[model samples]
Target: MFICSLFFIYIGEQLDVEKNLKKTAVLVGNAVFYVPSIIKMTTIGGIYLLAILLPSFLAGYRDYTIGTDVLVYGNIWFHNAILSNNFWNYLEWANNSSIGVLYATFNYVVSRFTSNVHIFYFWYSFVETALVLMTLRKNRIDIVLGMSTYYFLFFNLTLNILRQSLAMIVIVWGFNYVTEKKLWKYLLIILIASGFHSTAMIAIIIYPLYWIANNREKLLNVFVLSVCILFIVFSEKLTVLALNIGMLNERYSDYLMNSNIRGGFFAHLLFCLPILILYLTAKNNIGGSRDSQRYNGFRLIVAFTTVLSGFNLKYVYLGRVTQYFDFLFLLAVPYIGNRYYVKIGRYRDTLVTKLLIYIYLITYWIIIYGVQNSGETVPYILNFN
Candidate 1:
């Protein structure tokens, strides 16, 4: 994970350099600096060594976990799905006959040649990490920072849900496609992802709505009201429907019902209040432009989604539907910290500012990891070894 973070930072810096030769040199330099000289090491030890070296080697690297999902899922795909030939059974269950046959053929070919699942895990992680890097490139955020964010680490490392993780990668890639107005390409990606996990179908729904959400305020109210009503009137039905979908296992269902929505609510509240306060204090600061308006609209929609997580666990359990919005809070809080509070001329580059940001990010991670690990709500079956 940490080596991957360094790789992203190196790529980001090299993105600005001119000439293909210089770019190639930069890539080689990064690999030489980062990749180990040792020919062999245990996976866990290697990961630990990289983690320790990452921050020292790349001062600007932020821990991102987008690739973690692929790593976990790839482990599962290699061990349970391919090794045991269960992937065909899953495909058969979905009535994807052609896909089952293709997967069977691939599995047979691989098993005839190699028995090491770790190799498969590594290859899958590499490819998935590349895909995630590409998606992050489209967003123009710091790839290292984006990789380190809670969105990637918590779900990928802790939850260790493989199919859903792949689905998320697909969703991220789909977002890039949709944003570029490549509808057919976006749909194709979504379909491919859905083969891995049905939850990805949600992306199909979210994309069109994201496009239709032109009237931000109105859309906010409608989505909030609709979710609330859906919870109140159809929570049971929704629960049953989720069960029918067979995406979630029994353990996850119990977690949704038993866990305290209050803490989640409070977290959302804390996140939303800051945004609200910032908006009130700096509404005029935005200078009233179309882009500003669009940003504001995005803020509101995300804030509303965060708040809605508190309204119903059913929604949260519905494949972390609310989490898609939670990313907004993650991005917003940092921006707000830097924009409103840090820029008051009292704390620019000061120890206090840095400490506050560090503490906030650390605390955020602790809270997120704590809540996730609070119970056996979800399975952690990754081949961490």
Candidate 2:
């Protein structure tokens, strides 16, 4: 934990707000860094690779952390799953979970081969790490920023919300085809992901929303603002109605109806500040084709998260929904900062603005990594020991 604390500080200092500040690499998820590292594997390059892999290894090795999700949801579920030898039993389990058949089948197949949950966990962690790392490289998200955000927010999720994490990975992977406009391939991928986590189906709407955003930016902003306002006024009522819907999955229903835990105001504020800052600063007349697509993609996600953040203010439990979209901001904020700010604008390059961003990111790191321990891999455990 102490080492992680120092690492966070070092990375914070290393985030050069001024470098590559004018490129789409920030918006499109291309990470800005020392170019020399990319040309050849130097010391910085080695650190980048280590930064990506260390957390994944820790997650894979974790046994039972004192967190609500990992202790019960992951370890116990994997144990219970293996007990059912009959195919029908696995189906029954999947039915109760309201998860996809392939998801259940995957677990059942793994159970047949090994009873140790650690083995299954490592497999999930490794695959998840691969998926996320591939997405970072494929999309060109800065390695440090992407990995930092993943560790800070999404890593704990991979521990507990096993199905949805896999679903997220699938949806992220599907974007490759989505950007290509290969409708059939994208739909198939989404369908496969939904099998693991039904909530993944919501991503199906993203493409259409992208079309709306790219073509109708003004209307889309208005719509998002309206939705946010509406959610604020009638969130409780809407939450009730959503829960009452007969077709809602049992697990989702439980989370909404039964779970009482809600992330506080500070957490919501912290979660949203990065995007809001970048968005307010975003300017046009810059970036390339890659930048345009990535910008639109993140802008669309930011709009949804902005609305959901409002919903979270009222229906606190609705906060969970933000995870689906918030991950993109890791790229969006950096993109917006580099693309729009630091152009010697009246306010952007001023000492105060530069200092403020560094201070904010630094403070955020302290809270998220040092204090909150949200990733729940602190004092990282090695399973073999």
Candidate 3:
């Protein structure tokens, strides 16, 4: 699994070749102008297509044991629950599950074509990874590094929490709209994303953070600090209120009530410290640029996720809430590594910082996926029989 992820990372970086080709064309005249065009073919020409395909194929071909939900939930829905002799009859079953109407409808439609779960897996993985890649490309961030983060942190996650994975990706794509101040469009995207997973509804709070980041930066900082204290003090009352108000379902309400795993509070807090320091120091580095604004907006998002991390101290399910925003770290860490600097005896370089960031992310992957076996995705299983 790790080797395949590394291979995908290598191929994903090939996206940089497009920019290099464009530069080469200008320097060498029309001789190589069409070279980039040939690569741009949507079918399979560019490295971009190959990058998306390899991971999707690997994910799609995985056997049931490869992920916790494959045998338990996803394949069940794709093969039986959403399939019926008459397709329309399964809507009642679909509507009964926690799944959103759109995703259930998607499964029902796919089941009509065939009951083979592998094909369903392939198409779903394809769309999910494609959205991720397209979002990185659109943001003009480092696609290679963004993909590296995704491969480490999120790709295996998509294998288990299938529905929420789609929701999380949609919300990640919608982060740009939040920065752009597109209220209705962003809200609509959130609404659509919520159809995939109810947890995505929490993302609606992000735009307000964007507003406060731009208008009241100091207050945002104070709020982040206060969040831990307040949540710790009133965690029970807040959980009850949220459940009574229908913000959380019965399942999560029960889970929250039973959750006593409070040991990771400090670990979560420690995780936010370096990131908070990076945001505070690096703001002035890219002063007054659009990237600065976007970075500032995402920093507050990190802050918001920190507050959710605080909630996880008592109500551990808020951990899922934090996962929706994890992709931003890919953007934030790389941007900080490239842009943040320090003066050391009149010598300064970001190369060391970038290398450190890579080491940290890879170590995180090893610990969470390799050691902890998150999502039960450590042993990559192939379905060949």
TM-score per candidate, chains pooled? 0.59, 0.71, 0.80
Candidate 1 per-residue lDDT over residues 261-289, each given as its tens digit: 22355554553454454544542322345
RMSD of 2: 7.8
* Candidate 1 collision pairs: 63-147, 63-148, 64-147, 64-148, 65-152
1-385: candidate 2 lDDT, tens digit per residue: 3246327434433543333333222222675543432333333344444554555556666767623556645665667678777888777877675656766776677788888776676677667766765675576544444455555556655665677778877787677676677878988988888888766665665566555555657877677656544553464465457668755554564564322222444665676766565555556435687668767767766766665665565566555555556555545554554455443546444233334445566566567545766555444556654
Lowest summed lDDT across 10 adjacent residues in model 3 is found at 255-264
Question: What total of clashing residue pairs does each candidate reach?
Answer: 5, 9, 0
Residues 8-48, candidate 3, lDDT per residue (tens digit)?
54554553455444332323454544445444433223446
**Ten-residue segment with the worst summed lDDT in candidate 2?**
19-28
User: Looking at candidate 2, what is the lDDT of residue 369?
Assistant: 43
Pairs that clash in candidate 3: none
lDDT of 2 at 330: 47
Q: Runs in model 2 with CA error above 4 Å?
A: 1-53, 99-102, 181-184, 217-251, 257-262, 282-286, 333-341, 344-362, 373-385
Task: Name the lDDT of candidate 1.
Answer: 0.45
Q: Which stretches of candidate 3 lie over 4 Å from their true place?
A: 1-45, 85-88, 217-249, 254-274, 282-285, 342-345
Please give the distance, in angstroms, between residue 207's alpha carbon in candidate 3 and its true position after superposition. 0.7
lDDT measured at residue 166 in model 1 versus the true structure, 0 to 100: 50
